[model samples]
Target: MLYSQYLYQDDKPFKTTIRNYNASDFNQLIDIQKECFPPPFPSDLWWTKDQLANHVHIFPDGAICAEVEGELAGSITTLIADNHGEDHTWEEVTDNGSIGTHDPNGNVLYVVDISVRHKYRKTGMGKLLMQSLYHLVVHLQLEAVLGGSRMPGYEKVKNQMSPQKYFEGIITGEHNDPVVSFLMKAGRSPIKLLPNYLDDPESDDFGVLMEWKNPFLEKRKHFF
Candidate 1:
């Protein structure tokens, strides 16, 4: 389905609330994650009484959830690190193998994943979830945020197309994917494409690393 432009707007009147993810919320959060993504994380990874305990002990304040009228609408998990000098830490986590290390001032906020439920998608919940994370970055005095996107793979038909061309078409909205459109509107631009990043030999879907700088910080103003 083509992404609805309205989903990216913040002028809605939804009663969005931000809260720390707790033990009781784990199951609901995982359920929402499964409903939103193609290859969702295993339920064992997120839904358990011990999950919140682990998160709190390891990285307090890294997981956050959004609610609309008491329903679990979306969630984001972040890891803050020292100024890594670059804006693709999330990609690095997926590629280079380090997961929890950060820069000196904790200036880099790597958004591991952000997802919104399918029914609530086009009402700006995704952008709201993202903006909430931005506020978290500012609150923590972070420098930048980064994440990854899946670029569509090439097709070998009667007329084959190159992988690069397939990805370009996807980003340009030729395929009508809303996630790409939303990313572009959120001030995220692609940094690099990691070929075979997903390890699917037949799939040309490369990883597109994207980043967004804190606008308030860029203006030499304090986030607080």
Candidate 2:
């Protein structure tokens, strides 16, 4: 079989197109999430049809999806927050929490999640999704974009080791994950690490706080 045939199980060509997400797209969006995340978020957390339709309510105006020939390929969520100063004290209240610190006018873009299908890994779809989010952030005149990177886990090697050891490996790799490469490429800098910050008792997971300033902003300096 040809490469395209093997990948899509059909002879159709691959074409990626991005558009604002709608309520009708929920099931397809959930399917893409399942294909992308190893331990995917529960179905309850997946944005419902009503949620996607109200993009401004759940996220920023440009929150979008990339569909390849009518099939959901990836999705991204963006939002804004107020400047809360130097201390991330509010993080104590939430695991995937986001806050925008030090905005006199209270303007900052927070990218909540970005995911792409497994078969499309390393194909620039991730970057494309990010670029789309960035454009939305810029269009909204946000001060900056903030997000976190999770450490990769044993799903890539689950069959070879005990679950405990697999989690250990994930924690180890989290401290040294190559995510830094992508962040640096996107003009972002690592600000801090929240150790053992998750709500789940069994989760040894931590989070890395990162930020990317808007290069177009004038008189930019330290926020806090």
Q: Which number leads on TM-score? A: 1
Q: Quick one: best lDDT, which candidate?
A: 1
RMSD of each: 6.7, 7.5
lDDT of 1 by residue, 48-132 (tens): 3454455544555667787766688887766776444333433455223123353435666766667788877777677766776
- Residue-wise C-alpha lDDT for candidate 2, range 81-175, written one tens digit per residue: 66432434224322233312222255766555677877665666677677766676676677777765544433355467644454344345542
Query: Per-model C-alpha lDDT, please?
Result: 0.58, 0.55
> In model 2, which runs have C-alpha deviations exceeding 4 angstroms?
1-14, 40-60, 84-105, 153-181, 196-203
Clashing pairs in 2: 83-100, 83-101, 83-102, 84-101
What is residue 150's positional error in candidate 2, in angstroms?
Answer: 1.4
User: Which residue pairs show backbone clashes in model 1?
Assistant: 81-102, 81-103, 82-102, 82-103, 82-104, 83-103
Q: How does each model score on TM-score?
A: 0.70, 0.67
TM-score for candidate 2, please give it.
0.67
What candidate 1 gets wrong by more than 4 Å, as runs, is 1-13, 38-53, 82-99, 102-105, 152-160, 170-175, 199-205, 218-224
Candidate 2: residue 28 Cα off by (Å): 1.0
